[model samples]
Target: MAPPFAGGEEDEEARWCGLSTDMMEMILKHLPIADHISVSIACKSWRLATSDIILPALRAPWLLGSPMASTSLSWGFYTSSNGGQSLGLEIPTEFQRQWCCGSSKGWLMHLREPRNHSQYYEAHLLNPITGATVELPPFPPTVIKGVISTSPFATDFMLAALCFESTNFDKYVIVYQPRHPRRKKILIDNAMDIMFHHGRLYILTDLAELLVGVFDPRWKVSFKSIPTLFEEEGRHPDTYWGKLVESNDGVFVVYCTITTGAERQQLKVFKIKEWGRHHRIVEVKSLGDRTFFVGPFSDGVSISKMKSSSKLNIIKPDHIYYITGSEYSLWAHCMQKRHTFRVEEFKMTGNILEWFIPKLEDRSNLMVVTPTHSTSLLLTIIIVMLAVIGQCLLGWLSI
Candidate 1:
């Protein structure tokens, strides 16, 4: 009788199965976020190796549109780089009916229906890539505007929501995950937008002053004011929209001006610099290699080193992609080139357009595998080869 490992085929199989866990992990880290879950289920050793591996950032932001009224399984996505290629994704039925309120850190905050129709609906954070959901406390039925969090995966996270009561013209900012039963609330008369950055919460008011709130060790909130560079521009407040963004350098406040009937729009960016004890706003004439994507619901910006690469068509550095309030039309304004282009291929009608970033979570599709599976090894090898080819193509195009 032949030995169990005598054949060349068996030897080859054993060699592949004997790959070190660390080696497997290093290889998997280079793959995209979408392939993480699929590769984790390949085999026992591969599954254990990728259990804690971090994924690389592969693609830029894709515009996620609302599902069509006819089909609950399909959602639309537009790639800005590929000349606005329209792609449809099949999502779960539960997400089809819900309304997307906000998105951050690769998670979408949706207003889901209540278990019982009599009860009030609650908001839940869903990672559309991994199908993981985190339930949040119930919110009021009024127009809840803001939802920003430091990170959804962290143990100690700060979440803030701005609820607007149109009847009484009251606006309240609710800070969540408090020790006591009642969360902290701050009342502002005309707070327009709220953003959280670097352990501080910023509120942009109608007076063009940035309100800075810092939570103490005991979670008590204190407020201060920072002078803005917009005051020096002498532009009308009604013509511009302000948003807070974090970049590689530091925090920046961007003001985008789009008049009702004007043909040209302007974007003014300021960097928040700290002196001895005061925060000074410095105006920047160029964005370098960073592009800002601003929307009504959520605002996000992306930075890329390969500005002239054909693969990076969806987003270019030193540009701004903004959505109009009434028409919901998407437009890209190049800061350096001083030109404007419309992303009319998507044609979003309603106020549901949002920028979505992709991420992979380990808790969702992790499963124990056994060594009896040999087919999984083939699939993993194929996937790894494809990923390598894709990366090479991207690098070649970048040159």
Candidate 2:
């Protein structure tokens, strides 16, 4: 046999070739998900061994983190998959000047303003994973004309790039400064007052007018206004004030306080959903002011009677932590239960609540206050049973 096959080296090579693809795949599977990527480049054999594993595992990070962190005004990003390190992309130095954002789907949107002599404003969509960037076309001439004459108006431009409409994978840009001369229909002047809720962008332009716009990567890029019921209400416009609250189900509701002189004010809640056509408004009487005193506040122009509006800090879709001040004391409302805490009850001067979105795994940190409606009666039964069982002598004796 040795004489016939050169010490049987041919047999060894054949045995290596005879190894099953299944065995190779099994070895590749044992490697860490990240190292599996490197294993694919080991050789043609290993690359084939790893091809099917990349996609399913690569998309894991995309499906887990908080979508708001990627597209919100805070511009916060967190990833647990990459050793818990946030992706450090090179943000342009002009990012603050122009506006920049990252989407939940791992894409970035950058907006650039026109220079002294140029008439064009630039926007780009970038995929950091592949390092591919696509330049969005300039705003239409009419839109551009509208932005330039209104220098500060261009600065009021707000942008949202949504890769998928049904999902929360979107990016938002808010510009708070005036646009350059001859710039297009983009405005960021009121960008600071703008916030993204659900799939739409809402800008609190008025104590009255609420500007609602949809961000479409495939269109001319203009804000199609939605109807705000309070937009038409009367009296010293300064007397009527409002604030926005975003529900978890992607619905936005405005809590408006209309002061009737300095003593009386009415609190009204209006829900804004959809946009044109299907947009519906519903008034919620479930919430109201804690009889907080209406004040004489000034709106720059004149001293007008204004009410200290009930400030709602959204804890989640169904939970709102509202803070209101009365002539006697301060109050906090969570799940319709009102608790009054005096000005010095503990130690705090400003608003007591801070709103935040939790990561998928970190949700246990949140206090989920369930509504006490008929729907929660079933849950109440379960809780009461468990509590009784824990205290009953017979229950513990049987266990």
Tens-place lDDT per residue, model 1, 235-338, is 65565677776565677777767665434666777788888767878888778878777666664555556243234355567887777645566787787877
Give the number of the best model, judged by TM-score: 1
TM-score of 1: 0.75
Q: What pairs collide in candidate 1? A: 80-314, 81-313, 81-314
In order, candidate lDDTs are 0.64, 0.34
Give the residue spans of candidate 1 off by over 4 A. Answer: 1-37, 40-57, 67-78, 86-91, 115-120, 143-146, 178-180, 306-312, 325-327, 344-351, 361-365, 368-399
Q: What is the lDDT of residue 309 in candidate 1?
A: 21
TM-score of each predicted structure versus truth: 0.75, 0.33
Q: How close is each model in CA RMSD to the real structure? A: 6.5, 19.0
Q: lDDT score of model 2? A: 0.34
Worst 10 residues of 2 by lDDT: 294-303
TM-score for candidate 2: 0.33
